[model samples]
Structure formats: C-alpha cells, structure tokens
Target: MLREFLQSHLPQYLYVIGRPHLARMNYNELKIHILGLFEPTQEFDSLKIRELLSTDWTLKLTDKAVEMALLRYWRQGLLSRTRRAGRFQYALTERGFARKEWLLNNG
Candidate 1:
C-alpha cells in the first residue's frame, strides 16, 4: 500500500542518481524517516515536513504519505499533535523520541 501510494503520488525520480533505487522503507521505517523533519524536535504540518524530506533528493515522500504516517504515530501515542493555522502541527512524544533514538542506533 505504501509503495503503491508513493509510486502514485511522489515524483518519478528522486535526485536521479544514475539509477536510483527505492529506499525499501516499510511503514515503520518510513514514518521513522519522517521524523527527520522534526529533528532537534519541533512542530510541523504535513506539507512543511513533506517539503523538507523531499528536498533530501534521496527519499521520496508525498504530503498524503506524511499525513498518514503522522496520524498513525499520533494514534499510537508516539507523537503529539495540535491544530495550527488550519493544519496539524506535530512533535515527538516520549515514545517517539525513544523510538527515534533506537532507530538511529540500530538502523
């Protein structure tokens, strides 16, 4: 489902590294990767975070992908969200931070 969604919504290529390969990220990994946008930890809407992650020119992400991941995180109590400026702003909760730490060390 994630791959299908990305293939549909994301650009055809990400930075074009001769022959780029998909990151092979699963749902948990992709959501964890999304945490990059909040590094140093701050709130951000789906669009803002999507743009930031997309700019990496390596990973491909769509705003809808981000929204889905974020909502999942929120539902799992991994992140906290608040509505701001007609959009949802998100920050890592304790669980998120811990998971991020583990990901950094293990991934």
Candidate 2:
C-alpha cells in the first residue's frame, strides 16, 4: 500500500533522481518546496509535514528546521495555526496559497 501510494503521489522526476539531497536549497527554493506541499484548505502538523518532505520530496531536514520555517511563515501571515493536542496544526493562508501557485507557475 505504501508503494502504491508513493507511485501514485510522487512525481516521476523524483524517482529518476533517486532521492536527491535538497538540504542546500536557498531560502526561496525552500519556501517554494515547503509551501507547495499544502493544499489550499488542508492542515498539517510539523512532524507530518517533515515526514512528507523527507519521503515525498527527498529532503533531509531536521525537525527543528521545519518547525522554524513553519513558525516563520506563521509570523509572516502566510500560515495560520491553532494549538491541537499539545501541537500546532498549520494551514496555508490565502497569501500563502497565492504564493505557492505563483512559485509553481513561474518556476
């Protein structure tokens, strides 16, 4: 089931690269990749987002790095968050959604 899910959701190009190490990304690139993960109305916690970044995008980032980025976005009003079960659940704001679409389209 995991394999099937990966096959369905992961892009063909990521498989071709054999899991590239994307840790050296620039700020804008990192923002693009991270923001691209969310749907307009979807919410995800930090750990789940980190897992998706590692498994789907082949990014090897520390938990703190992801958390810091999320916090930054929250501060910038690109993300909204609420405390849930002792953790924060983050969702993209309208600005974030627009930015994600712009980045995807322009890149």
Candidate 3:
C-alpha cells in the first residue's frame, strides 16, 4: 500500500519540494552515457572521464560519483584499465563491446 502511494504520489511531492532529481535511470541510459565516452583506440584517464560526464549531461555529478561509477563498471568486467606513462587509463573490454551492441539492438 505504502509502496504504491510513494510510486504514484511521492515523486511529485518531492519534485515540488525542490529535491534533487532522484528518478531512477535505467540501464540503457547509463549504458549510452558511458558508451559516449568510449573511444575505440584512445585510453581515457580520470580527468577525461570526469570532463565527459560533467559536460555531456545536464545532471551534474561529483567526481567521486563518477569514480564510483567507473569502479562499478570495472568490477563488472565491462571496463579494463592500464598503466601508461605513470597514469592509469581506462577502456572498454570485449565484454563491454558486446554488451553495448546488445543494448543497442534490444532498445
């Protein structure tokens, strides 16, 4: 009962109260945002990733949030990292490529 009420009405109340947009973003939204930063050959470092996330989307997230998202993707085997020139660079793994394709097809 309470779950239904919140699902239907609480969101509007929250919005009217000037709360941060807490709408749940689905996997496709997350995937598209991440894939937009992915380069076939270029490796992304932390600064590059943060810049991409901040400028590309209207939703402004903190650096720590971006780092956490990257870490989550890394743990999911969708991202790989390497050390180059004393800095860590990130790229999508083979599994990530396949997943991206799948999401594109299904959505």
State TM-scores per candidate. Answer: 0.70, 0.76, 0.67
Q: Rate the local accuracy (lDDT) of all candidates.
A: 0.64, 0.72, 0.62
Residue-level error in angstroms, candidate 3, position 3: 35
Instruction: Show model 3 residue runs off by greater than 4 Å.
Output: 1-22, 84-87
- Per-residue lDDT of 1-107 in model 1, one digit per residue for the tens? 33333343333432233334456655455755665445546887777777766655546666777788889889988789899889888888888888776654555
Question: Which model is ahead, 2 or 3, in terms of lDDT?
Answer: 2
Residues 1-107 of candidate 2: C-alpha lDDT, one tens digit per residue: 32344344445543234655653655565576678777888999888888777764456778888899999999988899999999899999999998777765554
Q: What TM value does model 1 have?
A: 0.70
**Which candidate has the highest lDDT of all?**
2
Tens-digit lDDT string for candidate 3 (1-107):
22232233323332222344446655455554665467566579877887766643334578887777878888888789877887568898888778766655554
Candidate RMSDs in order: 8.1, 4.2, 9.8
Off by over 4 Å in 1: 1-23
Candidate 2, superposed: residue stretches over 4 Å from native: 1-16
Model 2, residue 22: C-alpha shift (Å): 3.6
RMSD of 2: 4.2
lDDT of 3 at 34: 67
